[model samples]
Target: MMPLSIYFLAPSLDLACFLAKLYICCCIKYVVVLRSYSLCLFVFLLQPVEKLKKMDLSYSEHLIQIPNLCGAINLESINLQGCISLVQIPSCFKNLDKLELLDLSDCENLKDGMENLPLNIRELKLCRTAIEVLPSSVRFLLGLLDLDMSGCNKLKDGIENLPSNLKELRLCGTAIQVVPSSIGCLMGLSHLDLYNCEKLESLPKSIWTLKSLEWLDLSNCPNLIELEDCTSSSLRYLKISGCTGLRSIIALPPSLTCLDANNCTSLEEISSWWTPTVQDYDPQVQHQNNKSEGEIYNFEQCLKLGHDTCINVIEDGARRRILSALDVYLYLYLFLSLRKI
Candidate 1:
C-alpha cells in the first residue's frame, strides 16, 4: 500500500490546519517540508504524533516557529538546518526520548532552549549558530558521539562539560580562548578539529594524553605561542599551519606520521625526540598506526628554524625509517618524502 504524505504549499491557514489533522489519522511516519515558503508549519498538529519517525524542514527560509513536538515520542531524526528565521527550539524537545540525530546548523538567531534537548541524541550539528554557551545539561547526553559547533563566534565556554564518550568534536572558527583540562575525559575521542580559531591562546596539557585521538587540526590559530611536550598519545596527523605567533614545537607523539607547519613565521625550536623525554619512550608506541604506511613533515617557509634544528627533524625521520621533507623558502630538501596534505 502507498503511504500518505503532505507537502506544504501556499495554502490558507485553515487548510493547513485541516491537512495537519488529516495526516495524523493516516499513521504517517515521515514528514518533510522542503523549501517551505510558509511562515509557520504544523507538522505536529498541536497533539501527539506517535508514529512520526523523521521530520525534515531543511531550507525552510520563512519558518519562524518550531512547532511543539512534545508528543513525538518515536521521532528519530529532525533536520531544521538553514532555518534562518527560527529563533529557538521548543522546550518540549526534551520529551523525544528516541531522537538520535538533530541538525540545526545555520540557525543564526537561535539563542535558547538548548538545555531542553533530548538525551538520546548521537549526532548534533549546530554549525554557524548564535548560541553563546553550551548549557551544563549537555553532559547528560551519554549517547552523543559527534558534535560540531564550528563558527560559533559568540561561544566563550561550556566545552568542559562535553560527554566523555564523544568520538568527534569540531570547534572550528570559534572564539574559545582555552581548552579546559577536563578535555582528557573524552577517552574514546578520535577526531578533534579546531581549525582557524584565531582567538584560541592555549590548550590544556591533557590534550596530549588522549590515547584514542588520531586527527587534530590547529591550523591558523595565530594567537597560540607554543606546543608543549607530548607524553603518551596516539595522535597521527597534526597541523599547525599559519601559526605566526608559535615559537617552538617541543615534542610530538611516536605514532604521528604527518606534521604540517607551513608559514609559521616565528617558529624557532623543535625537539628531536618524538616523545616528551627519551625515558618515556615505549616500543609499542610505533605500533599505533592511522591506516597509513608512510610519513610527511612539512616545514615550508619556516626560515627561523636553525640549521641544526632542521637536521634533527630529518635525522629523527631517518631513524624511524620514514621519509622527510623540509622547505626553507624556495629551497626544498626531500629524502624519499611524499607531501600529503
Candidate 2:
C-alpha cells in the first residue's frame, strides 16, 4: 500500500538522524577527554609553580632531605630553622643561584664541612652551628647584606676579608681571639655584635673608620684593654660591658644617644675631654665588694680629681679587682641588649 520511494526515504531519514546523534555524542566525549587531560597537565605544572613562591619547611617532622629542592630554581627564600635531623644541606645549593635568603638556624647536626657558601646569597644565618673558620672564599659573597655566625665556638681565624656591602655582622659566642683590621673595609656596616668573644684582646684602631656604624656591642670581651681614638659621627648606641681589662673609652662620637658602661671596673674614669649631648648616660657603676681605703674615694670627689689624678696611688692589686668588677657589669648589660634583639 505504501510507495517504494516513500519507504526507502523513511529508512534513510531515520538512519541519517541516528548517525548525526552518534557523531555529536562522540564529539562531546572527545571534548570532555581533552579538557580532562588539560586539567591534569595544569595541576601538575601548578604544583611546582606554587612551591617557587615560598618554602618554609622548618620543623617539618618528615622532611629529612632536601632532594626535591634542586628543581626549585625560582626559590627566593628557604627557612630550615629547627630541622634537628637534617644533618646536611645539599651541596647542590650552589645550583639555586636565584636564592636570596637562607636560614639554617639551630641545625645542630648539619656539619658537612661547608666552609664556603654560594656568593649570590644576600642573607645567611648559621646560628648555633659548629662550622669553624669561614673559608677565604667568603669574600666572594659581595651581595651579602646580613650574616649571623653566632655560637660558632670553634671559629678561631680566617675572617680577613668580608664583603663591603655587609650591613649587619654578628660573631657572638665565638672564640675569635683577634679580628682582622680588614673589618674596617666594610664601610657600609651599621650593626656589629661581638658579644662574648672572651679571648679578644685588642680591636684594630682601624675600627674608628666605621663612619656608618650605628650600634656596636663589645660586651664580655674580658681581654679588651682599650678603644683608642675611635670616632663615629653616626654611632648612636654603644655597649662596652664586662671588658675586665678595658682601661678607657676614648673620643665618643657626638651622635651617641645611649652609652652603657655598667660594670667596667678597669675604666678609671670617663673622658672629660670629649663631651657630647647624650640622651641617656647609664653609668651603672657599682663599687667592688672588697674596697680598699685608697680605692674607696667618694664618687663625687673622684669626679673633681681631674682625669689624670683619679685612682692615683691605688695599689695595682686593688685596682685590678675593681676594674674587673666594673668590666663584668658593663658586659652584662651589653649581653642583655644583644639578647633583646
Candidate 3:
C-alpha cells in the first residue's frame, strides 16, 4: 500500500513538481504544511485530490495562498489557524460543499474574499482576524451552528445578517455598539457571548424574545445603561459583571437560575421581581419545586443597589430557607407517623 498522508516541513521551489508527481496516486487523505516561515508558498495542485479529508497549514506565517480545492469533493476540515500572512480565501473555496469546519483564527491580515464560503459549513472560527465587516452572504449558511469572531476589534457591523441556525456565537472584545432588532431571527441560538464589548450601549428589545437562548454574557460593557422589558422563557444563566454604566434592570427570564451582576457600580434599580417567586410550601410537592433549584446570585460591589431591591433579594432568600426547613420537618413528621401506625 502507498502512503496516503503528506507532510511538507520545508517546501522549496521544486515542491510543486514533487506534489505533481504525488498527485497521480490520487488517494492522498491528509496534508500538513507546518511553519514554512520564509517562503510565500502557493500550492496549486495539478490534479484533483479526490480523497483528501483534512488540510492543516497552521502557523505557516509566510504562506499567502492555498491551492484551488475545487476538486476536493470529500474534504471536511481545513485548519488555517495562525496563518497570519494569508490575505484572502481562494474563490473556489465555495465549491467544497462537503466542508464542515474551517478555522481562520489569528489570521490577522485576512480582510476580504469571505463572501463565498461553503454552504454546508458547520463551524467557522475567525477569532482575531482583520475583518471589518462580515459579508452579507454569511446569512445564507443555513447549516452553520457555531461561529467565533471574538477579538475582532474592527468589527462594528450590525449582526442582522448572521445565519439563523447558529447555536453558539462569540463576539467578545469587539467594537460593536448595538445588537440590532433583527437578532430575534436567531431563534435557535443557545449561547451568545458579547463580553467586554465596550462600545455596546444597548440591546434590542427583540433579544429577550429568543426562546432557545440559555446563556448570555454582557460583561464589561461599560456603555450599556439599562435592561428593560425582558420576557425570555428559556434563559438559564446571565452575566453582567463590570458594567459600570448599567443603572436599571427591569425584568429577567422565568427560567433563569444563575445571575452574576458583580461590580455594576451604577446599578440602582433591580426589577421588583428579580428573584423567583416563592410559593407556598406543599408537603406533597418536592422541596426542589419550592424555589429555583440550584440557584446562584451575585451582587458584589453593587453599592448603588436600591434599598427596596436589597430587601426584596433578602426576603426571597429568607423565604426559601424557611421553606426548606419546613420541608425537612414535614418529612420527619411523616416518617414518625408511619412508624406509629
lDDT string, candidate 3, 40-157, tens digits:
3554443556666767768777777787778788889888889887888778889999999999999999878787698999999999998888778999999999999999999999
Per residue, candidate 2 scores C-alpha lDDT tens digits across 1-341 of 22211101111234324424543443211110000101111011111222353455465433456644455566678777766667666776776778898888887776663533566889999888766667667788898999998887877777786777899999998888888889889999999999999988888877777877878889888799777765444565677767767777665553444455546667765453332222222233123123323322222322222455333222222333333354443644643453355
**lDDT by candidate, in order shown:** 0.76, 0.60, 0.77
In model 2, what lDDT does residue 35 have? Answer: 9
- List pairs with backbone clashes in candidate 3: none
Task: Name model 3 segments beyond 4 Å from true.
Answer: 1-47, 274-293, 306-311, 314-341
Cα error, candidate 1, residue 259 (Å): 0.4
TM-score of 2: 0.64
Backbone clashes, each candidate? 0, 15, 0
Give the candidate order by descending lDDT: 3, 1, 2
Could you tell me how far off, in angstroms, the CA of residue 209 lies in candidate 2 after the best superposition? Answer: 0.3
Best by TM-score: 1
